[model samples]
Target: MRTIDECRAEVFRRSEEKIKARRRARVRAAALCVPLCLCAVIMSVAFMLPKGPRTEEDMMQEDGEAPGGASGTEFSNDLVGDGRDDDVNAPGGEGSLSVSFSLTWGTYGISSYDSATGRLVKATDATRPEDYVTTYRLTDEETELISELIRGLDIDRYPDVYDPQAGKLGSDPSMTLILSVRMGAKEKTVTAKNIALTYESEDPDGQLFLDVCREIVEILTGTEAWQSLPEYEFFYE
Candidate 1:
């Protein structure tokens, strides 16, 4: 019964109401989506960020060098103790023995023994000897054996340097051996180049030097501490 104008007006009103409902639906959807989008963005940014400092075990697991060209494990001088033990200087005292051995070539290694505390420190891959080091304790019997071997070397009589004669054939040495020993007030250091070649040539001094080096190497390598260390990555030819 309505007039045409009323019919038209009613239809227009319905259209407006539908449009408004659609706009309200869109607004509600946007409100919900905004928080979800923000949360997603925050999570993505957090994942992209760098992690914190690595732990020692993590560093070691990677087998990578630590900062300052050191091993993952920190080295402490306290592990070896201070050399202030009075017995170290006393003649015939329990602590009057100290010995150090080193081998250098493409690779480097060193082992030091101190009687004062029966402490033995060994380092390998000694590109930086102070970086990676391990400590062990020596039994009294082992200590006495080392002391006996060093004394038997008559190391004082050995020349400070042993270089092959210039004309000596087959003397191309590829490595160097250094031994330092201190007993009470007496100390001696011997440096032998091409020690292996000399030892093979049946030189008395070289033979003796290699013998002592082998003995020390045997002792150091036989310990559990040495076994626990990472294997040598490089070697001398």
Candidate 2:
């Protein structure tokens, strides 16, 4: 049903559309190259182009010189673990002592020591350095013994060490250790209950405080003071 002239006209129309599409593609390609052209100009102005590959021989002459060479920080990867020093049973000594009493009566456990001959007492009942008050709380006998320990501790060295509630015991205000790390010259105080907790905490780089108390306990309670000691350990079980 078609003639040669009509077919020829349709062919000419398709050719025109293809030519327009090719021109549009060329225009888009030129647009895309515009930014590339700008970047090329920037690089050209920034640095001189290299003439050729520079081998080791070309770099050999400049080994000793640099533009602004400066030293960089270096670190060692050799460090391991958290401990800085690990040595026990060395020069440092340790000790601890505990006495049971009541805070309601305003009396707390007392201990005394003298390094001169290395003597320690619980109370001074008969003005004897060896004998100490056994029952009465803060009696003249106990006060004398406590005073001696206070003097030995170097009041000038341990201020603000005692706590206000140190010798405290039962909630009844009668049973307490009364160890107040505050007051006095170089004094640190703690109740018998707290003494146990402090030694257990043994914090800050290792038991330094525990060591000091251990020495004091050795003086006051003798070598076997803790042979039959009792402590509560489990909270849930």
Candidate 3:
């Protein structure tokens, strides 16, 4: 009973209804995502907020004042730590085994190496010090180095111990050793000595020395081989 024009209009109306329904569904889907997006934004903001910086209120409280006040800090240093600082026992004396060591390079300078990290590094303490505290890369190592010195030897196989009154065996080689060790200490003064071991060899053994020293430092100080001064105790300049 309807005209062709009327039928075409009905078809177009149906199409319009379908389009509207689709748009409504899309709006609902997008609405579902809003809460999740909002939650993510809130979490991001919370994570980025600064945590360590002191607030104005905190600062005021710390300064012992309100509003604007001069900031203050309280800190203290241990003039003396543990009994270790009070005594410096000699190397061989009874109940006196705490010792620090030093190496004298003169122009050659000291070198250090680290076995823990397998990293061999060098120290630029090229300028020698009047008094420096050093350690053996290893206690066993120190024993070896010291024993070797006592025997008058070098890194390479060379025997240089002198007989004093007797004639010296081999000629002087390339370099010399400057070994100074603090064996023990008293209430006021500590006991230390220096031993110079000359070598009949040449060539800068910086890298070799560094590796050896690093090991020694590790043994004596529980660190690496180069000794600066008193890493732990109180001492005079």
lDDT of each: 0.50, 0.33, 0.35
Question: Of 2 and 3, which scores higher on TM-score?
Answer: 2
| Deviation (Å) of 229 in candidate 3 | 21
lDDT by residue (tens digit), candidate 3, 174-194: 122333333233111111112
**Tens digits of lDDT, candidate 2, 1-237:** 689999999999999998896566434434433443344445444433457898787687445345333422111111110111121111222221112111210122334433322333443323452434222223334333333333232222333333223333224222223323222122244433333333323232113223334333433453332222222122211
Task: Tell me the spans in candidate 3 whose CA falls farther than 4 Å from its real position.
Answer: 1-99, 110-121, 125-177, 186-198, 201-237
Instruction: State residue 186's C-alpha deviation in candidate 3, in Å.
Output: 7.8
Which regions of candidate 2 are displaced past 4 Å?
A: 1-107, 117-119, 124-130, 133-159, 162-198, 223-237
Best-to-worst ranking by TM-score: 1, 2, 3
Pairwise TM-score winner, candidates 1 and 3: 1
Kindly list the per-residue Cα lDDT of model 1 for residues 33-99, writing each as its tens digit. Answer: 3454354445545654549878888768557664444443332122111223342333545733444
Error of 3 at 47 (Å): 74
Those runs of model 1 whose alpha carbons end farther than 4 Å from true positions after fitting are 1-131, 163-173, 197-199
Task: Report the Cα lDDT for residue 197, model 3.
Answer: 29
Model 1 misses residue 39 by how many Å? 87
